[model samples]
Target: MSGRIDPEFLRFPFRRVADAALHRALEHGAQHAAFRFAHTLEASWRLRDGRPAGTRSTTTTGFGVRVLYDGVPGFAAATEVTAEAAASAAGRAVETALAARPLAVGRISLAPEPVHRDRTWIAPYERDPFDVPAGEITALLADYSGRLGSAVGVGHTDAMLQVARETTFYADTAGTSTLQQRVRVLPEFTAHREDPAGELVSLRTVAPSTGRGWEYLTGTGWDWDSELAELPMLLEEKAGAPAVEPGPRDLVISPTNLWLTLHESVGHATELDRALGHEAAFAGTSFATPDLLGRLWYGSPAMNVTADRTAEHGLATVGYDDEGVAAQRWDLVRAGVLTGFQTDRGSAARCGAVRSTGCSQAGAFDQQPLQRMPNVSLAADPAGPDTEGLIARVEDGLYVVGDGSWSIDSRRQDFQFTAQRFHRIRDGRLAGQVRGAAYRSTTKDFWRSLEAVGGPQTYLLCGAFHCGKGQPVQVAPAGHGSPSALFRGVDVVTTRGGAPW
Candidate 1:
């Protein structure tokens, strides 16, 4: 709630535009209206080998108006920030709603919510990444890449850093208003080496982006020095190791890899809109239909998941969603059964829920908001063992770290995932690094195979930007938290189609 809020958060004429837009919408016979504005600044620096390869930055600003007119919804947006433009957009939004009323699927019924007033929420941060000098940013990237490139067998190194600051304002005719700002950063490094097979192999860092500022890159959340020093050795070991033997094998998956699995399988699958078959295309419909709510066994009894928007430094953490509903935490799975879904005010009402879970989000002012995924995470068992302990419990298996390429059906059921690095495990110990390993399984079968998870000490918050959805393809940021997990008898494959040798 307290931090260095970006000046751009308040520089816009939020109240003036909102008043004009709402007044006009009401005059046009709209029952409800909301005004929204957003500004985002993004910058990135990249290094190759030992020198700067590229650098770029961009800024975008826009405002939009939305209205509920005679049981239908309409939206319009513009780059103009004036009150006059907002009023015009409001009128157009009402017109759009009127035009669609005749063909509307069903009457819109939004869940009731308490009006929140005079609210200001700022993402926690110590230093602003944007405020850092460009020279400093490039110097850091170059230095990291150079250090890695100097290592033996390290033929090439790539380093990059990207930062973004998003500011938003919202005001609804229901007497809710919120101004918010968030800062996020992502930094990555990779090393390449030629393997004994004379094929180039690559390995990258496993650190995930978070809702933090410049401080994150400077050793706040991650141990950069240790990771950089270990990269070359890890890559060297991986390049010469044998290709994974494909078959059913016991596996211990690190949180770095598990977070993405949760994001794709559990997080996206449980969205109310997708589950109810009201949203589709960008991501396919969900198999967890309404009829299965509280009936489907999503996983083993060890699987417990929560959808939240208020975890510290979480990418999706916020005080309020685009719909003017307060952020909340709710169970998605309990004792391995479907318990709830991520919902917004409208989706909640449609699904017979009493209140919103505040999952609604829009990437920018020009886009229509939808019920998006929150920071969905698996809860760690209080008495569970640590990661090392989990590994010790595995007799013969593969241990995978970091996420790689993945694919799943639109139903979020059957899927395959590869990782940055995999190590063969024999007799409860890692034998050596292995190359070209991927795991394939259905969502239900995979989760059911989960035998145990590391305790809270092994949990990590990880996620990415650019979660894409909707027709025009709106992108949102999200987070997922998980612990090192053990899965019994999982199918493993070699990317190069190798057999046991």
Candidate 2:
């Protein structure tokens, strides 16, 4: 029920329409012109205690015309899929750029990129969730929920599945054309138990979404059977777990929880636009500015971070960005030193970078491409220990697993993070679980305190499904890969008293 090509999307006369738009813009005295057609499909299915909760599937298809005229960039889009509409939009885009020429703060400039011709890339996956019948999916959700909800000490169960497929076609006047597609899936289930105090204690699956297909939930990527079987007992133990004592202690952070820490502290802080103060919205400007590049000690000597759009199965992986820059991998932090920043064509030109890192991303056809995030990862030490081995080294500490909630300043510096499960580690062994645990530290101090990192086997790719940015607020997916890491002398707090803001 799956195929490598999207016949429905290919059926559209996108090439004919894109050529029309490009021709129109060039004829209208435009210095540069590009046309893009994008189609996105999103599906979600949910169940609560073996009963249908909600289901939705949405499809968005549109085309946009962008032109560089009179030294400024302008963009226009239309839902209509026709050459005439695309040509009209091209003319309007050029007019808008001409009208705004007087108000433009600076003449637009782009970093040089080699022309890419007739390139196509599709993310590797075997099954399309869309191909599965709705009734079959519903039955699967119901069965998973029914098993959990009926378990001992488990009063409620919730499960959900979300999947997306994006198909795009881009053609520019400069002899660059690309057709690309990406598919991703997210599936999760949660088990809840009512404690004696009438409060609900819950635990959720550690596996989040990945750049895979329907096979992800069917034992291709994660083992649902083992997780479901063990969830009820874990929930029962956690419900009666004692509250953690607040103090400075050694901490072992699993990738499930550490990935979010990386996303907040390192990912957003390294966006070149955010650092330059050109754009500030969701997370605000960064503390890691151009002035500190190549000098700032971002972490311990054990730390090495890379921003890449070329990693296999990376959610941000792309063949080419909107600016026609090929995907690349660059160092953001190497041996604890700030080495690079995420850059698009504009940011690369401003920052004296020779080329864009291929990070220019647009969430949809209508949205202007922004210097967005890429798959930022903390590299694992080649010869380091595994998670269990790292845990065995701790005399007294807390092992944090699964992301819970996070609080960080606009600068992405000072932050506190909580986790879904915190186990007390004593004398090289896990004693039991602890409740109401959180770790608080400044971004710099936290990274600098890194004691050790686990080997590749302990690494995991984890991130949020959506990250919001821009004045109009556009969101795109982001990823962070990390190994189980150990940090020394971090302040652990009890969040039961309420948020320690």
Candidate 3:
């Protein structure tokens, strides 16, 4: 069942409504039409001082209509789930297309694709987190916080859990009908020790968001017991490690820390919208310009990156995108060269491609579908060595693990990232833990500096559940997988107030 697409979701009543809506739009002279019905539930839990601090749950449902007339596209949506409302939406969509005719640069055409109907998918998970008692979750987090914060020099400890379930029904005039259900859970905790004397250090769990369920909280994909046991000790060590001196040195970055780099540099840069300069507002744009698609050197020959829409446990995994295109996997960077772009149906046609990579999405039913990201990841070299082996190749360097404060320019180029913990390496061995360390580099220069990548054993799939973009500010969840990697002498800086304060 893992590789097979299930058709069970069409059994829901929403599918019937979607079918009728699509038919309604096409009957109204729409050259292309799509109907999307979505139901999403989100729950958030926060704990402070061995008790529940806050808890919130939100549920949203609606349907949208998209249409294409003689070379222009328009979209309209309604909260009402009636056939008449859908027809009205289709009518308004045509009006919008006419109004935007002058602004459209060229004929709006979509890449052609074969139709698939009655297909379905459900993200793999054991227990649904939404079904778990909210009180039980809060109690666990509160207990963990209380035990850790009670220690000396500990100022505060906080924990949170976020669970979401999304069910969607999509139908198009081309005879494709797809239904999907996915669940994602994010469990996180931060234990911070602060002193009024201006010293503070915090340690957080490394549990990234995943397409899982309640079992994730208990112990399905993560070992909550072990991570909690080590939080207090790690926090104490970080509090005492010597403040680092800024200088150039070799770097061995763990998968936990490298995932963010992949997200900013590779993930956003390859987005078809960013590449085409459509994301110029808050989401910025891309440095991987169209002219550099096949010629640019993105990284070292050891680097292999892919944009996957079907990765297991990936938050972005779906049966079909909002544009009614099936999911796919395509390369973004291969052997350091820019190989492909993450694209939607319209964007693919604009880019002279034959089909979409299925990167289209709408944050909610009220929003219009736009080019979005998938599970953009750096594939590990299975035949290579592990993290320890890579570290052993360096006589003098720093081993950076976990994530910390990060900053990247609007161009997704110049950036500086700090790590949760830094360990000094001398004579190919870990010497001591160091505090206040950061690394900075331009996007191109940084990736080109890749020295080696660890084997599969060192790979970790990590990502955030909230990647925001677009004018109305739609947030999407994405995943990035990578193995521990080594880089040659890179610019290392200490976060010890470089500017005169």
In candidate 3 the C-alpha lDDT for residue 391 amounts to 89
Error of 2 at 30 (Å): 1.6
Q: Could you say which candidate leads in TM-score?
A: 1
lDDT (Cα, tens digit) per residue for candidate 1, span 1-501: 346666765677778988999999999999999888898899988888868889889998988898999879999999988889999999999999999999999888889889999798888888889999998888888788887899999999888888988888899999999988888888999999998767898989888899998888889999888888998999999888887888998989998999989999999999989988877777789998888989999999999999999998999999899999998899999989999999988989887888889988998889988888999999888889988898898888999999999999999999999999898889888999887789999999999998898899999999867688888888888999998899999999888844632
**Residue lDDT tens for model 3, 124-144:** 888777667766777777877
Report lDDT (CA) for all predictions: 0.89, 0.89, 0.83
Deviating ranges (above 4 Å) for candidate 3: 1-13, 150-153, 195-198, 498-501
TM-score for all models, in order of appearance: 0.98, 0.97, 0.94
TM-score ranking, high to low: 1, 2, 3
The segments of candidate 1 whose C-alpha lies over 4 angstroms from its true place after superposition are 498-501
How would you encode candidate 2's per-residue C-alpha lDDT over 1-501 as one tens digit per residue? Answer: 223657899999999999899999999999998888999999999898888899899999999888889679999999999999999999999999989998999887788888999999888777888888989888888887877888888999999999999899988888899999888888889999887788899999888678888788778867888888888988988998888989998999999999999999999999999999877656689999999999999999989999988776677877899878899999999999999999998889988888889898888998878888999999999999999999998999999999999999999899999998999999989999999889999999999999899999998887778888886888888878999999999999898886322
Candidate that beats the other on TM-score, 2 or 3, i.e. the better one: 2
Residue 102 deviation, candidate 1, in Å? 1.8
lDDT of 2 at 143: 84
Model 1 lowest lDDT segment of ten: 1-10
lDDT of 3 at 77: 89
